[model samples]
Target chain A: MAEAKPIAGTRPLAPKPMSPHLSIYRFQINMILSIMHRVTGITNYFGSLILAIWIASAATSEQAFNTVSSYLATPLGLVILIGFTWSVMHHMLGGIRHFVWDVGWGFSKPAVKFLSWATLFGSLTLTAIIWGYALSHWGIR
Target chain B: MPTTTYRTELKKVRGLGSAIGGPGTDHFWAQRLTAVSNLFVVAFLVYTGLTLAGAPLGEVKAFFGHPFNAIASILVVISTAIHMRLGMQVPVEEYMPHGLKVPFLFLNTFFVIVIAVVGVLSILKLFLGN
Candidate 1:
């Protein structure tokens, strides 16, 4: 037996026409920067969580606090710490970009391009400076 | 400039100007939500910090021993978890494929819930003598 079909059928089962295809539309600059803002924000939040835990643990007792501090003493944990610090810096600068946008500037073609570029460059620069300071204080002789 | 054209282009990308929009699911809105929540969390933390400053372990426990601090700590945990979920949701949506994306979304949700429960419970127990 043949299967049931919808009411709209053409002569001898011709394929229905699709409207049209629109291609050659690549993603824009702002989209990528927007994505980065979200990524770093997530990392930064979890980083804050670790900080909170460390604070609570410290409040509990020196023994409890020492466990976390000792974990922080390791190289991998320090890498995580630095990665989170970078995430915080990156998200902070990304936030300033949006703050300017909120005040109704930097949405234009040229201005947006500059602002997007600046977010990346500024985040990298700030992360570098802070990590440099952190390492000097924490790194060995 | 010609950027007004992009507005129309965006509309055309969707089949219709349907009632079901993204429901403020964009990165910008999520960031704004999280930013505001973070401010509140920080304020609460600061207030709690001051109250706990120079407090001994028993006093610290007693402070959070109350119903209000228990509620506030729960709020801090829950808010931070939600903010993290929203923030990470944007990243996965932007960068992941459908197959990989679904699990990450679930993972994000689960991670948030677990942290909120465990973190809040641990804090409450510290105060409540449980």
Candidate 2:
């Protein structure tokens, strides 16, 4: 390999102590679940806002109510609704995981893994069941 | 280990090396309380929503006009909104840059409060037959 050359007007980088986090720690299931919890939480924030808007519009007038409802009938609206539903399910499971921790159990290594996996699979199963009903009955509406 | 020390065992151990009364303890408990409440509220809201979907404007209003549905809806809005604020505050405090942290915290709180206020007002209107 050829020797490296320094860029013009650039000083050499200094070695310094850094905090340990993502860069240092090995990946774990709980770590991923932790991130998923935060992501789904942010999703729920927006989902709740949309829900609030929907209700507020209903309160305003029938026309406003219809407008919001009709938008929810659209393809894009359907996609958002589905995604939001899944987000809620996922975050709810995350909350349950925290509750279990609070109850003074699920701290053993195996138990932790079991709870994490349950949270992942349970959210997906519940979301599928809900959308299953929606799709079967409404057929894209 | 040191009985010779002036402090008693109780005094030595009191509020030492624990987060019991430190900052964020109340926030932590509040989050847990809301989380538990939200489980019930969200269930009720989802059930009401499934029944109300594609419902006509008058029917939607009437459904909400029912006291049970109306109170449940209001509770959902207030509890979930407060929960959202509390949850989001953690990430803002953790991940936001130092200079922007306070601003982001204020914005997060204000946003939740505004949405919640509007939601409660809407629920009240429907409940009161306004």
> How does residue B109 of candidate 2 score in lDDT?
90
Report every candidate's CA lDDT.
0.67, 0.84
Writing each residue's lDDT as its tens digit, candidate 1 over B73-127 gives: 7677776677777777767776887689999889888877776766776776766
Which tens-of-lDDT digit does each residue in A21-129 have in candidate 2? 6988887798899889999999999787788889899899988988998899899998998889888988999899989999898999999899899999999898788
TM-score of model 1 vs. true structure: 0.55
Model 1 residue B30 distance off true place after TM-score fit, in angstroms: 5.2
After aligning candidate 1 to the native by TM-score, how far in Å is the CA of B75 from where it should be?
4.7
lDDT of 2 by residue, B11-118 (tens): 345745335676568788889999999999999977876777677778878898899998998899988998999999989988898889999999999999999999
Clash numbers, per candidate? 0, 0
Which candidate leads in DockQ?
2
Segments in model 1 whose C-alpha atoms lie over 4 Å from true places = A1-35, A45-64, A74-79, A108-141, B1-31, B40-76, B127-130
Task: For each candidate, give its TM-score against the true structure.
Answer: 0.55, 0.83
